[model samples]
Target: MPEENYDFMMPNVNFFGPGVVKKVGERAKMLNMKKVLIVTDTFLRDLDNGPVKQAESSLLKADIAYVIFSGVEPNPKIRNVKEGKKAYIDNHCDSIITIGGGSAHDCGKGIGIVLSNGDDLPALAGIETLENPLPPLMAINTTAGTASEITRHTVITNEKTHLKFVVVSWRNVPLVSFNDPLLMLDIPTALTAATGMDALTHCVESYVSVNRNPITDAQAIQGIKLISKYLRRAVANGHDVEARTNMAYASILAGMAFNNADLGYVHAMAHQLGGQYDAPHGVCCAVLMPTVEKWNIISNPERFSDIAELLGENIAGLSVMEAADKSVEAMIRISEDVGIPTNIKSLGALPEDFDKMAENALKDGNAFSNPRIGNKEDIINLYQQAYKA
Candidate 1:
């Protein structure tokens, strides 16, 4: 095989497996970070109930000073970022450690980036706007999706505009990320299923993205295979340590792929549903995955065929196009098997709002990376297909 020229990006350190949560404080100490600001949500700050307590206890045992700013919410808003920034400054924190899922990581990134750059949150809305280096930051991921912990992108909603803005920069990437399956033992089955599917969607979209290269293809395919083999098991039995471990590894692999290759319409469309309806990001991705892939198969039949084979679809003598369609069918089957709703209507999205959601999807940053460039009408049609399932 010829050497491929590709820019593969990832966090400096990715710690995984059971009992790895203990390493958070060690990594922070190595970075010379003493006083840390822990960014998360109220639900994640309850010492007895939150996963963050695990890290907090580890930090305390390590004799590292810290303060908690647990105000982050789902589809995290700029207001949350502002409040977190104040907390970071008020506590005289030298570093940041985010504990939870993407929401917590994103809020931490937002606060850290703004504080280090001394720039207003609104000014850093677009891609690579923060020119200066950010403060030392670490992320501990509890979900199997989003991959925000390891990525340079952070999606923060501008409440006034009712639109989600993605802030991207190499500087915003965390210094380290911890993925401990032991910490994921308690996530509900529904959340496990939804987040697992979101990881699958990331692999599928990145594998077929316009920016995909050989390096990304390897990670994406491995991620797809792992999700196919383990997502159901993890969802069925959250306490299955092996299943959770495979899922955590799968999420990290998928994150590395999309972090560089980027995503496609599934994420483009799902972001709108999440912002507008406050729907679970993974559920929205699960609902839209099959429909968007169906639309995309014609544009890149070979890529979809590869996906079909990876998912264990029987494509024996079928043509590429037929095999591609089989991949879409496989996605839908897996979604149903994991208990995802069959249609957007189940999420309370009305037909009347389809136009607005479609418009937003069309304008999403991830849409530009899709193999098939879709206009407003195409997006609207896709929404209709998804709405009816």
Candidate 2:
């Protein structure tokens, strides 16, 4: 291989496996995380023996005092970030611990970034706009995940403007992140399916992205293989520790890939759906993955063919274009079998809104890394295709 150069990013430390939730407190204490603000959604905080309790118990054991801020919402809103920041200040917290899935992590990042940088999310909406570093954060992820646990970017929706913003900066990346399969053992099948597909999207999108390098490609390919082999098992039986563990590994790898290479049109489009409809982020990605990838296949047919093999296709003597088609078919089949809706129309979205969303999607940071750049009209057409699927 020739020498290839690209930036690689990761959390300071990652703890993986069963019972590692306890490490949150241990690591927090080691980092001198006193009076931590635990950011999460109400549902996870109320769930019995869920991620919140697991995190709380660890903090208690480590004698780390904490305050709970359970106001984060699905497709997390701008107000969620503002309220979370207020909670952090009012409680006089020194660090942050976010539990649950991507929403929780993103909310925490937004809060921490604003607390140190400024109150305006729109100001810091682009890459590396934050002036100050965030308070130390430790993310204890629950779902198979959107990979927010490790990524440096935060997605926050400005409810007033109906715009979703991605805040990308190293300042807000979790100082530490880890995945404990035990935390996911009780996850509902639908959530497991959605999050699993979310991870798969990350791998495939990054693998074919313009910013991708040899390093990210290796991680993306491994992530794709793991998701293909384990997502169904994890969705079928959350109690199956092996399946959960492998999917967790896949999430970790996917996070690393997209964190560096970044995402493509799938995330760009999904963010629009999430901001506009408050749809489940992973489900939005799941429903759009096949449609977007099919449209993008021409940009890198060889890579799509490779994704087909990772998705369990027997591509033995198939041409590149044939294998690429097989890959899109595999994505559609997996998404359908996992119970994700086949079309965006089913999400109660309006075609009338597509024009505005397409404009925003074109400006999304993820769209910049897509192999084939799309215009507002192209994005609108893509939405029409997804809606008609």
Candidate 3:
């Protein structure tokens, strides 16, 4: 038989710390970026002292010209990508810089994907579909979740169908990624909780992914540890520099893990809720993770046991199955401690929609990597479990 194989992917370059945002201008100039397009949301652009202004300061110092596209919504939409493409073309932008969280990064990727290929965004959905290289892109992240800045994946929503689709391609990875903890200090407590838990979900799902390898295992384990220790602190006090910094590391590490090993049912199921309700992606992940894992534990009890230990659960005396169950318990405990809503019902999900959500979830790119195999009925029951959980 042929040997098993996998590939690892991340940004070409990365900068992490408290003041790394200051490097954007010089980096763009180094890349020969003339007339750059800065993609963000209106909120970030309007903030008096937000990351966008800081990036502008650096770009101005480097004498790089740029136009702002701040039309990105919570779950980036097809129209947002279309409008961003128009902005890029109209401004004659030779490069792209995205500021803010995953929405901004994904939107930036979507814009570049269509510009380099064609205008049909929906037609380009799925893995390794892009044939052309995106323009030089830099992502300056403002949130500690989603990790879109470094990954080869981007999620775009089709507003007409109310469905989210994944676009995965090595070419879509950003040229550079900046993670400055200082920018995350102003994030609200609820957002902090949701995004941090999102990082945790990435660690867990990637650790148990069917495609996991030694490299991904190491990163995922460390990500779980960092998130377990610092997420609560970051939520309790946004100004905790140490928490912010470690959480940044946690997010990047988890991104690195999942970017290669890929994800599982948590992301698959979460994507549906996000598209259906236009809810927060991280929040949806946080709510559904434990339920999904509860079903997935049987696929690899040792991996779940490792996650339990990483989360600081006391499983010394328990059997492997019992210890594996602690992983789900630990997830729930941390989720509740960080203020995630108890169930999807609170996020506006209805029973009538579960069937369709389940159908779309099974078709999601992440579903293939899920450790456990289940049918439509199993997926629907998982949704029901999360709804009442």
Measured by C-alpha RMSD in angstroms, how accurate is candidate 1?
Answer: 2.1
Q: Residues 1-389, candidate 3, lDDT per residue (tens digit)? A: 11178778998899999899999999999999999999999989999878999999999999999999999999999999999999999889999999999999999999999999899988888899999999999999999988999999999999998899999999989999999999999999998998998899999998988888989999999999999999999999999999999999999999999999999999999999999999999999999998999999988898899999999999999999999999999999999999999899999999999999999999999999999998889999999999998
Which has the greatest lDDT?
3
Compared with the true structure, what per-residue lDDT tens digits does model 1 show for residues 1-389?
22256677788999988888889878898999989999887876874745788898789888899999989998898889889889888889899999998899999998887887765676676667887887899999998988899999888877886667677788889999999888888888998998899899999999999888888899999999999999999988999988999999999999999998889899888887777777888999999999999999888899899999999899999998999899999998899999999998888777787788788777777887899988889998888898887
Report RMSD (Å) for each prediction in the order shown.
2.1, 1.5, 1.3
Q: For candidate 2, lDDT tens digit of each residue in 135-254?
A: 999899998868898998899998988788899987777889979988888889999998999999999988998888899999999999999899888888889999999999999999
TM-score per model over all chains:
0.95, 0.97, 0.98
lDDT of model 1, residue 106: 91
Model 3 alpha-carbon drift over 4 Å, by segment: 1-3
| Candidate 2 weakest ten by summed lDDT | 1-10
Give the residue spans of candidate 1 off by over 4 A: 1-5, 47-50, 118-123
lDDT-wise, the better of 1 and 2 is 2
Models ranked on TM-score:
3, 2, 1
TM-score of decoy 3: 0.98
TM-score (C-alpha, index-matched) for candidate 1? 0.95
At residue 245, give the lDDT of candidate 1: 92
